[model samples]
Target: MTLPSAMTFLLGGLLLAGSVLSKENPAELAVPRDTTGKSQWVANHYKRMMALADKSPEKFRIVFVGDSITKKWLDDSGSLWADNFGSEDSPFYALNLGVPGDRTDHVLYRLKAKEDGGLGNLDNPAIQPEVIVLMIGTNNLFPPHDAEQIAGGIGAVAKRLKDLRPDSKLIICSVIPSNSAQKDEELVIPANATLSALAESMGDDVRYLDLFSPFLDGQGKKNTECYEDGLHLNEKGYEVWFSELMPMLKETLGLATEN
Candidate 1:
């Protein structure tokens, strides 16, 4: 499914334009109020992703879907991306389908292709991913939504992803501990527990990755060293994430352990 050189150039141009616009007003690039009627920035981002999926010569074997944490892998932690997935010769081609400030509902909305949302186009046999790494639900804990609502939202996302790409292995990550949410155990703890349980109940296709302990201290407080703010991962945090993630990715995808 390689694209012609001219088409590739045109796609690059379109992507650059979208990127420029997204950068101008980053807030508008997050999940839209109406997934079916995505903002211009969101639409551009989705369209660019679809174009890349359609034209890339390599198969998209690994996909990371989440909010800012996942997006940071491409932006702040780009060097890590190069270190892990930069090899053009490698069989694994990864895509980051993260929108900043996305909640579980937003993710579910994005996965709904019938309504012209999600990356559902990749469900086409040609570009379907071999693995989809999902880390969401944290944003839902902000206010109003309780643990049950957040968990339910995530459950819906997992179900939808399964339905959309049944053959792909789904890795559901626990919402990492945050500075602000650390003391609010009633909300954070229960939400993560629910997510873990959801993964366990989903059978072999879904695996839960708990990154909480690694990012927390013995007192169950967020390790300030790992985060730039209370929420977002710093470079050191990303290092921890990549270290933990690589092993899981290898095991799930049956890739060689020797890196």
Candidate 2:
């Protein structure tokens, strides 16, 4: 066939294939809806579990739950959390249930299943988590989503946590400081604002802690050694986390504040 004729034939075939593909994947054609609520549902659920722990007597088993930052703290080959809290022999066991690349939506599902003891399952009704440390909203800062939506999603997750475990203590940690200078920092600020606001709105039942300030040097930017990347914390960073967090734990659990 001539070059022009062959080109025309190929175009016709491509169009037919495209039509078939579209029908097979209707989702591609559908308009995307806002995921703010969906994301917040997970946050709500986490908060429920944290609230449930507050009523527990004796030791309060705590779980730090979030994305890569939370996961790294748990996966410490040296057992950073365990060492900081003493050990399994300590007053309370700190369970690391942080999953990598997880958004608020992922956490909501995990809580229902009790896959990591963050949220104990119905079958194993014996286990009850006393506290939950929640820090999320990094990924939601991308385009097409605003900070309010991200906050709403996180709020929903907090609600769910409270509902599932009404007695647990809910501690909402500020998102660790971020240093990306791109996009005029608007993307970063809104999400953090939303998270901080949500944490405050929970009242005394849910407490909020901000660690962003300590992680910084004289500069407003993040301390270089505190984080491996501009996002996640390093050992020095976790050290800062532990220093600030240990006191909160003692106070929340009614341990002796005097050191």
Instruction: Give the candidate number with the greatest TM-score.
Output: 1
* Candidate 1 wrong stretches, greater than 4 Å: 1-40, 114-123, 182-184
What TM-score fits each model?
0.78, 0.68
lDDT per model vs. reference? 0.74, 0.63
Q: List the residue pairs that clash in candidate 1.
A: 110-118
The residue ranges of model 2 lying beyond 4 angstroms of the native Cα positions read: 1-60, 76-79, 113-123, 142-144
Task: Please give the TM-score that candidate 1 achieves against the real structure.
Answer: 0.78
Report the C-alpha lDDT of model 2 over 1-259, residue by residue, as the tens digit.
9999999999999999999875442211112223366566545544554554343323437767777788677544246666654255675566555655566655665655555443442223444557777776564544324555555656766777777777878887765666565521565456566667776777676887777678768877768888788677878788888787878877877889865
lDDT of 1 by residue, 129-182 (tens): 788999887777665366666677777888877887889899988888865664
